[model samples]
Target: MLHATGSLLTIDVGDRSVTTTDIDDELAAFIGGRGVATKLAHDRIPFDADPLGADNRLYFASGPLQQSNMSFTGRMSLTGLSPLTDGLLSSNAGGYLSRNFVATGHSVVEIVGESDELLAIHVTDEGVEFEPVPELEDAGVPAVTDAMNDRHGLESEHLVTIGPAGERVVRFASVMTYDERAFGRGGLGAVMGAKSVKCISFDGDSAPALELPNEDLHMEVHREAATSDDIMRRQGTTNLTEFLNDEFSLPTRYYSELEFEGAADIGGNAVEEKKYEKAACSVCAFACKLPTRDEETGLETEGPEFETVFSFGSNCGVDDVVDVMKSNELCDRYGMDTISCGVTVAAYLAANDEFGNAELVHDLVEQIAFREGDGDLLAEGVARIHDELGVENWAIKGLEHAAHDGRVVQGQGLSYAVANRGGDHMYSTTMIPEYHGKIDPEGTAGKAEHVIRNENLNALRDSGIICQFGVGRAVEDDRFERLFDADFQDLLSVGSRVVELERHFNNQRGFDGEDDWVPYDLPDLESSLQEYYDERGWNDDGTVPADRVDAIAGSD
Candidate 1:
């Protein structure tokens, strides 16, 4: 795979067609890889089309720094309307897929339509194919991964597939990539299910020649990763649990309480003690994926990352780390979102007073995994659960049933409500600024700016298809701009413009100030909207300033 030819390819699963587009040096220089992909996705899909219909498109795009020697840069973004939140959703994952996708001379793979039958798209240097995968019809994530690895030879192919959760259209189902990595938010897996796409198996032998702006800049970011305060390389991401639990007491159980007694038991240290081997993403220097077996269940699991740890451990009142790992493994195998599954399960317990009925809850878990009985109700998310159970105060009360409790992380609460995807954390992560004291998560005043900025920047990052951890690991502020060939500020300004464009796109879909506030359940929750707005020069409403929107969306 030579840089002289366009390595990026797009495949239309609906029509079984392949197309390759040249990467304009200008767009290539500014947006880089993932950013460009976001622009393309926004431009391609019709605004009013059903997200799950054949008209919707899923763009799995890689970034310019993907195959390069940047630390934790091997990531790709899955962009589309999330079936979970019903809003713009994009989540990144680390694995060999991004590297393979790019190495094969393809930057993007576009999937379209609700396929009439069960199928998997195999992308290779020889082109692409929509092949049958009836053998894995009801298999779970782990089984599906093993079957694909066995059939394709694990070392040669990279795969992304949906487990039974996706097959059953769980609203929060995630799209699992590689073996352990996942685009694990906003029900993108359900979108894949709606399209009848069982899996994506990618193979390529063409090696990419990824050179940075200057080898010096690449070396600098690489060196920083090795010695800097970045947590992934220094302590692995599992350490985030310690930070979140110790700093904010953020592990809410079924939206009722903020603290968990077992936080330390599920921390990074616990993972090291229990897991077997550690692995890294493609081209990544840090080996953070802790592949381990639970001492009690003897179940081999990949991670109990901060999100998973909180989502299943503290959030579900399941204190035992081994139980959390087993539960995590179960969710992944079943192709369900750990956060939503755990939260939904917790909500169910709270709703039915079954929080005390371990046997009933266990049966429900199995049912949800298989989409049977009450499992069907659980599959729709907390909102639906609240409706079905008819318990207003006991369930996840937001639109998509993402994280619990709108009262605690007010910024997150606003994001859950306004996000087109039901309830989600990633669509716009305001936690970073709030946690840093740059904005107030407890006040709703400046939230509009906080939410919009994070959403835009994260969208660009997600679109790059690189791991979100990479943004913290390699690229941050002006330092990250060095990864691109363009000037640092210029590259970021381009990202700002892309952000505004996304806002405009959302506006077309009827997103407004009303969609920018916290859910009704959180009577005390507020955000830094006022302060954030003052800083960004916006009105109290959080709408993009007319001048700002004009500057970004100029008369084109």
Candidate 2:
């Protein structure tokens, strides 16, 4: 195993004890990050454990590429039972954290049990320390990062933290790192908050010596990133805003409409006008992160990315881009997933007929973080409270939908129905091909195979700890096999195993083919789903067979 540290670190927050064990088998078999983390979670997390309970564990892990510090390798993976979906889930974030994490010399770290008081855990090559942090209870993300830097001399890159939203156990709360980057989709932060954990910081210098297939490959990719004139570098992800809105679906007014009249005001060009600086992750030269500021109002933040444009801008009928930026800042400051928080707020606007009330939208973000007034119900996420609000439930499996309008992008619609993470665009990522005209976007007849391959490939990418934006750029073609020290098909197989592990784990906890669903209808959905199951060799009920489950069980 090229990047194997040959060890695992298990932390029991309750007892403040640490155990390190050999996990070379897992490292080699799963290829670390999402794959290894999923393998561990499938075996260890109790099937019936509450998502926010002490029994639920969160796994933070790294992959081989971290050692290279390559252009797209500055990311890491995390897996756990989801507070939002009540099923197993995994998320990854890109930042300066992965290199620091790999420095601790453990490829995988498992956080389990709960603490009686709010706490922070520090992991280093020397050892682990649990510090009771009662004074930091319910602190916001900025406050925690400042205290960690001021009191402990730990920088933003060294900390993984949750804000007031997580401590309040908001189902859509996010786990943040590098100050702004997030393990964002699932409510992993709520799980941390449920454990009474405030933050965990990493620092060390005992990184393993990685064997690269081609030493110059990273620099080659870095040069490509540095010189590329990708439009995303100019506007970040919001570059897709006006285009998706004009040609496809932007999910206006809580998905009641598909077009926004004011999209130009909040689209990529608008965001570009506010961008004052450039930012990148770790050694990555892509520098695609949006660092925007409104000098007139003295407001600044990282991004109101394309999704935020949909969620807070068009979805809630607010067209002013600055309002969306403020909403983005609040979500980051309070440690919440922007997609879930924005969509939940959009749902609120729909139910109350308050669309376009930007002030109310900002209030909702803070309210959800603090669980105040109507924010409490909204904090439960759209799936849990849509009925009481007398509005259409736009979520699937408790997760609110992203900006990609599945009704227009049919393959993505199919992906949303069956994704383990539920309605998340990145889970299968059919949107890219659909946007590029690579796949027919009007039907699901022959889309199952493509969806399966994409899911598997993304699974491997998460394990690789590679940024998704770098897919076609830094790590495509035969380069993927070379970097991972494996064949193309074999890597896909590893990804398939990871996906099956998650599905099987969630299956045991009462999800099945029935749970593989979408809110809106799609053409030939039934046959496509059958094709998907048949391709994977799963049971008709959408459950992984015992033999396949056993094949991935344990490190052995």
Candidate 3:
């Protein structure tokens, strides 16, 4: 029903051969991005397969909205079986990579097998080319992207690279774009490293013609976003630090406290002082990505986003904005998830409360990236660290928590507990309503219904692969019909079905009620969990009924 000219590109690294197949049925059933990619993971990866082994496949997928003129449609979804969680993982990043990917005339790119040597894959209009990149060994993400662009001529090409963390197979490695955007969770970069892939560069001039249902409405949304007084427009996501800190929802000292003492030093105002420039993804009207530079050190990098500020700053007991920027740059360059890296460091620093030691945080991030000294243990992520050190580490299903403190935000807590990807904030962000004052942040009553509805809505957004912030505001304004030509209710139904599919996949792989526990001991947690399960028609034991699953699947 959408476009069918694009094929699913499959590459076997072992033989260095490429194949293409039409995925019309898959496109119709699962849509694209997370849905289609998760379906591919379910079909191709064995439950018992080692995540880093040849049996596992990595899928980079773009949705139908990709390459459209619509705002916030530039995001891409990367799905794989996570080595950390040992479950289905999908991470999204905003950049030109998805646009370039769509331009290559492919809906999905699947890489299988493993390369015997360090290599890079270049995809162009003609075909795929695998080139050995031995020189890129032990390089950081920024360096690798620079090298790839230099080699290929950077005009229209975009690079997705892994750094030292991935090269060493750190369990929380991240896959990064050229400008430091990352598919930054669940150890996906390790999957690329396990396959011996240094980078994947995309270059093409073929863009599928996009015909929006209402071009005028699309323009209207863009006009509104461009001139809107949204905090995102003024200060980017970094604004969340101050707001969350004000609400006492910021995780500080490894969740030992709900608020940070030095919140003012690393918040929106502080970040604005060091802002070097503002950046945005392809066709995005809300240019929320800010690249900052420290005047003293002259170290410039893409972000120290709200998560970075909370994780590296407050969570690690550091308050210096420059220090957070340095840590963010190091994580970006080294190819590691900032949330996991920062939280892991916080666990090691739990004994000390002095906080805000820039030098100490920098050295610690370096050690983790290179696996030097205690970095080896931290590199294993929060779950394994908790097991080995007997520390009270905060994580759900092996993935580390985001910036939100579950002890305070009951709705976020419930969503975090049941999220398929484990401790993911974006999976079903109840924060939107909380932030907008539509819902009481401290209340637990009726939160389960709110979370369930938001979860279903978010599933549709992610499957459409739209930027969460942009589409989130659109959904709030009831503009889905204007932008996507789909009824909001229909989209929510699709989202509910996607949520069921994800839960089913996790269940088949042995996750149950026990795995749905939040890391924190909140008073209202038990009641909230019960409410969530009851609202979603799931059994009290956290199992979805087979008949319900069948009905949802049948509707699809």
Candidate 4:
């Protein structure tokens, strides 16, 4: 019955045979949710697997703590090889859809083969079925969500649907799982589109039995995070703009300059002052989700988080919060990855002289959504845009323009450059330790050591499916281990260390230590890696010391 953990369901439309199995001991420890799914994808799919081909597998996984009283726990991961990065891609979303795993009594859904017809996979506590989604074709998330509610006759049922962005197979397209919180990032949505799977809906009244070390201890941990100065009590990550723009002065604009004078206009206080509503995920108490209603677009949506605000607001030279909100809504509706989508649009605008024309911008967005004209080129992503448009001024790796100066961030920048998925911020945000405040923001000295540490820590977080916000304070210290019990600690540490080995895995795929080098265009790009390697105790190559690798591998 798949009671304690979730079930893994594999459906082959080509063979018309469905196999369902319980998430077992080996799979649970291998990658947990996100990490484990990546392991499976790497093993199952060939390096030459066409991202949108029938041979690829679309992975959807729910964590163990999903439906419990755990805070901010409604997260599901969709992982596959991305056509954008042409490497591993894993995106996560938060909404009621995660709760459905607990209700429907399953952990992961693995679907294979191409369906000639449009279909939505529906799962209930009773069982699973694939139904045609004629009404949801080319529809955005909100519209599809409404249609699902009407069909199921239950508002509680969560819907994971993609918009035209996904259906069009935009290289940076995302799957909008929850209405607002997306399985966003990477080209996971486009992978689903290639399979002709429109969406997946499920709901049920069920909760798994949680295995807690101690009831009192568990509640105590929650109390600290819920009331801590870092997460709930502070202004939240929304306040990051003020620190980056005003204090650190590291906000990037079209990859030309860092520092935005107009940042104050869109600061966290501005959001709270101008907007009066807030939203949160399924069981989360800390709703950092700031929903603003724009008069121009006549739409209301959650977030414009620090990344979105920076990428779309200041980075693109648009200062109005309302304008940023509209852009945010448009990206969400189109099922586009906000980070990549915004950066790709900005790249085009910066490259094309016609970008100044308001009409051209409108046409570009429309065409990209509908897959016509220059939108075809624009939908491919910044790297592709650089190749097609011959603009080398700026490009992205994980989905973001190189932030904090690609060189100054050291191997962190290396990870960004060669990340299997593309330019990403969260994959390696070691800026905290590597960057000394008020110093040369462009300096790359002593960054490799910090990058390795933070990357491992972040890997642990993703594998554990915990929010970075809750662990922000502990990110630089050992307190990070306090969040989990002893039993899970061994797996977390091993998994964290394994991330680098996987980086080596990419190295075996033709990328190298030289590939870790930042583009020489940035001011400090040349010296960053050398200085970073020196500080990290590496002998020139960015590889970790074998002794340390063995020590970590032998842990627990």
* Top lDDT model: 2
Assess each prediction's global lDDT (C-alpha) against the native: 0.65, 0.89, 0.81, 0.63
lDDT, residue 195, model 2 = 92
Model 3 CA lDDT for position 152: 74
Clash count per candidate: 32, 0, 2, 10
lDDT winner between candidates 1 and 3: 3
Off by over 4 Å in 3: 1-5, 155-157, 351-354, 475-477, 545-556
Over 425-450, each residue of candidate 2 has an lDDT whose tens digit, in order, gives: 99889988999999878988899898
Residue-level lDDT of model 4, residues 270-339, one tens digit each, is 5555455656666665555677666555667666776777767666666666666667777788888777
The model with the greatest TM-score is 2
Local lDDT at 110 for model 2: 92
- Which pairs clash (backbone N, Cα, C closer than 3 Å) in model 4? 6-107, 7-107, 31-36, 397-422, 397-423, 398-422, 398-423, 398-424, 399-423, 408-444
For residues 1-556, could you state the per-residue lDDT of candidate 3 as single tens digits?
Answer: 2322367899999899999988767766666788777777776788777889987888898887775666777788899989888888889998878788888888888999989999999988789998998988999877776776677775323888899999888999999885488899999999999999989887788865555566676677677767778888757888888778886578888887888889999988898888877778888787888888887889998778889999999988888898899999999989999999998888878745435666888898999999999899889988887867666858899899988766677678778888888888998898677767788777566788888888887777777767888765754535665555666676676677777766776777788888988876656777778888887788898877888867754533
Task: Name the 10 consecutive residues with the lowest summed lDDT in model 4.
Answer: 474-483
Candidate 1, RMSD to the unseen true structure = 4.1
Q: Which ten contiguous residues of candidate 1 have the minimum total lDDT? A: 393-402
Which runs of model 1 end up more than 4 angstroms from their true locations?
A: 1-8, 23-26, 29-34, 154-157, 207-211, 224-235, 356-362, 391-424, 427-429, 436-453, 463-466, 470-474, 520-556
Off by over 4 Å in 2: 1-3
lDDT of 4 at 177: 65
